[model samples]
Target: MSRVRIAAEIAGAAVLLVAAIGIGAFLREQRTEPQSPAAAPLAESLAAPTQRPQPNCAVLGQVTPVPVPPLATVDLANGKKSITSAEGGYTVIVPTAWLVQPGIIEGTAWFGQTRITSYDPKTLPRPGPEAPGILPPSFGISLDLQLWWNPKGEALDQFAQHMLIGPDQLAVLPGGVVSVGGKQAYRTTIQDQRQYQPATGPVITTRQTRIVWIVPTDRNDRVLVAYATPGESDLFPEVEKIVGAIVLTTPASPTLPVIHQRDEILGRWLYDKSGAPIAGRRAEAKLLTYGETVAAFGGGTGLPRIDRDPDELFWLVAVTGPDLPQGRGGPGGTSPPTAWIMYEAPATNDRYEGAGTRFASAGTWPADFDALPDRCR
Candidate 1:
């Protein structure tokens, strides 16, 4: 919603684009770490397969696994595989033929016939703020998915209704609850307008419908899965195939525990709503993984290694002090982040000595950025 952003290509996402969920692969859990380059297995040796790092929201520390592996490396031409959201701590068994990639924003990921790459969501060299009636094109037809925490514990249908009003959205068809993994999921379709004018040809216009599905998790978090395609495509079967197989957690899956286990870790540093560490404790923090950070304000090049992820969102929070803060950095505001150096768990605070980080939050990203009053931006 700012001049510069990586995701949120669609308009009017009031709360739709704030992704905060992760899913494993088609395997959805029951561990089986994928193979790596150097650690080739021996012919007759029994080393017990390398285990996947238990998914969790604790400080990842300075040296996370070198090849954390690109977000979506395994391309299944056809079959099944596990896709983890890592951010939201969920897993789904999607069709391997689908190219899986991180969602447009953090706490989100998606699968489809095409992969979104080679262009910047923040700035397109061709010039953006694209004309109306024409939605930005993607690699090909894709089904995007992501979910944010549901604080008030709203019912699935209520949440779906709130997600339908996008900026370009033209109409909302009636929808109702459907079964997915035995869970009640709200399914609906929004009529959206799009167009394209080529230099050498007449303007090409196509009718597209954003088919959306909203499902509630046992965790009180709501998940949104959308596939924007021509109105004629019958995606219900495939969509059901993907959403029907979601698994929230498995015995082997590493989960971001509500509280970090180690106190010495930056997570141990505690703070109050006013942004101050407990009276005698020092302030400290660490960078966040998808599960704890927003893709728009995510990792970028040239940033402190500690503060960068993939650099999707090109915004930085700069608070003047505890008294007069600026940017979307204030609680209930939309500021990016305040600390990179010292932070508590769920780690995405953008912080420093004068600025302390908050461990609790109403939502991720702006609502959770720590050190809201100390950074210079």
Candidate 2:
């Protein structure tokens, strides 16, 4: 099996381009008759938000709690470009010199001298008619923003302590705290060594520096911001400036009618390895609701398949079934799933277990699980 870097996994389906008339048709289909005035108040009242005391940022594992200035007040006067994402639920100012391409899994913006990439689970790739044949721009320096969920509300230091050395080594920094999007956040500096084989020579070792920021959000989630630079290169100060100008919009709370335990597993799920979207392959889990019993099966390419029987082979693990585990999901699984388990390959025994992240429903999932076995098994 070829070893692939999880960090390199960024795939987005191409956005569908439609004519004005097509958009009109879509709008018309969604139009419904107006409700009576007598019922309008009840509907409005039901949608009103309930008030609760604000939670302390520090207690929530946020390091800095400085007052945040209005997003418009930021010194973005020199910026010639602005990126606003209704789906990403955030707005930030970038230099006009940067090149921007927004995707559902991750958004890439290339600054003349730097590249900034932002990723959040709440923002997923909008399903396009097909995959766009677009190539990502290159930059010597990269800034990465990813989403992290802290449902248990672990302390910043404790959570940081539990961080894995995945593909890199991290050294905790003495820097007090950093602020982003008017929220308190912590920072860490990491040094990583990467090896690549040359066509005609031995492997080369390269050292890089990554400065990361952990910024919390409204939900029990946080955005991880990191600035990566080449050997001996210092770009945190410049990158921090771009990050500071960010203003994250609150994520929309999902509203759905009460769901049955079995039907909750119906939506699309993106297969992930250790929290990162798997490259190239699109994995989906399907559940057939049979009376009161929900049968589950997992299928996807680019990973090993579990064959238990000859007639049918599925990748699965037995959980309590009804009550799914609560944890963060990736592109496919938007909200925390009821329960989740990793997909384990039989070869390594238990070395490589692929986890599935819940994503928004595309409304086009196949009812049959047979196709999955064909591609996966």
Candidate 3:
């Protein structure tokens, strides 16, 4: 080989040796470098042991069974009693322990009767007279009225107003929603003062009232189940458990018509104490039939009064209208009813008018003849 070529080859070999040394140094540095602290495990401790859930006392509490009582024993003349004739167009199992009573105002198809029964004192409060601790059991037949007409929330507010609470009234707590009696329901708890009559003085008993509003699926029907106790605490858990056990099987179809015969009498008309009509002025009449008997009243000149009752055999005055304003007097507001007083009874005549009262007048008829509107005709 030429001397210059040999010198070039030697220089190339020296450069290759330097490159190999540099690569080896870089790899060695990489292998010996310390790892970042963040990459290391935070601690050598083991993970926390799995926690056991706390036991719920409500679920564990012993349930008190409701006592059964005879129907005759429950029906004490003054006490109300009603038997379950129908349930959802099906036969129902009569609750052996409960005593049913006819509603104070009877004859509506939707409302049958109220139910009454005493619960275990351990589970409920003991009954005492004069603001007694006794629970006045009640039941309602489902009506097809508009549900939106009376919202459960608003109804609950009304119930709260009627309830008597304790001196140390606790705050009301919302319990959310739950299923009750196979129906959707909202549950809530309220702490209130219950008035109790003591031999010495009036005692204010602290209590918790649990309310459940059940909205039916088929109709605008709703069932309200309420349980109250003497304490400033929650009774929902127990109340729900007890109410859930209630099996309300439908009863047999009523032999009598679903709507009583008297329902026909419930409408607007005019009448007097003798069933006589007042001349020159007409009074709006309304009838409310319950069961076999009927209640009729007339208003417009003033609030209505009971006019007649074929069954009751006498006229009974029920309610009176308020005094009219100066210019807004009489049925037309042109003049006050002269000796014109609204009256209600079981019977009345066609024409009977006195001074200050016009006997002849014309007015619009109600839309429905079967029943009167809730407001004045």
Leading candidate by TM-score: 1
As for TM-score, the candidate ahead, 1 or 3, is 1
- Candidate 3: list runs displaced more than 4 Å: 1-110, 119-172, 195-205, 211-213, 221-239, 245-277, 286-377
Question: How many pairs of residues collide in each model?
Answer: 45, 12, 59
How are the candidates ranked when ordered by lDDT, highest leading?
1, 2, 3
**Per-residue lDDT for 50-87 in model 3, tens only?**
12322222321222432222212233354332233233
lDDT of model number 2: 0.34
lDDT of 3 at 361: 18
- Cα RMSD for predicted model 2: 20.2
Worst 10 residues of 1 by lDDT: 19-28
Q: Please say which candidate is ahead in lDDT: 1 or 3.
A: 1
Tell me each candidate's TM-score: 0.43, 0.40, 0.35
Give the per-residue lDDT of model 2 (tens digit) for 128-184.
212121111222344544444343577554455444333444454544477778878
- lDDT at 274 for candidate 3? 53
Candidates 1 and 2 compared by TM-score, better number: 1
RMSD of each: 17.5, 20.2, 41.0
Better of 2 and 3 by TM-score: 2
Each model's lDDT: 0.37, 0.34, 0.28
CA deviation > 4 Å runs, candidate 2: 1-79, 103-139, 164-166, 169-175, 195-203, 221-235, 254-377
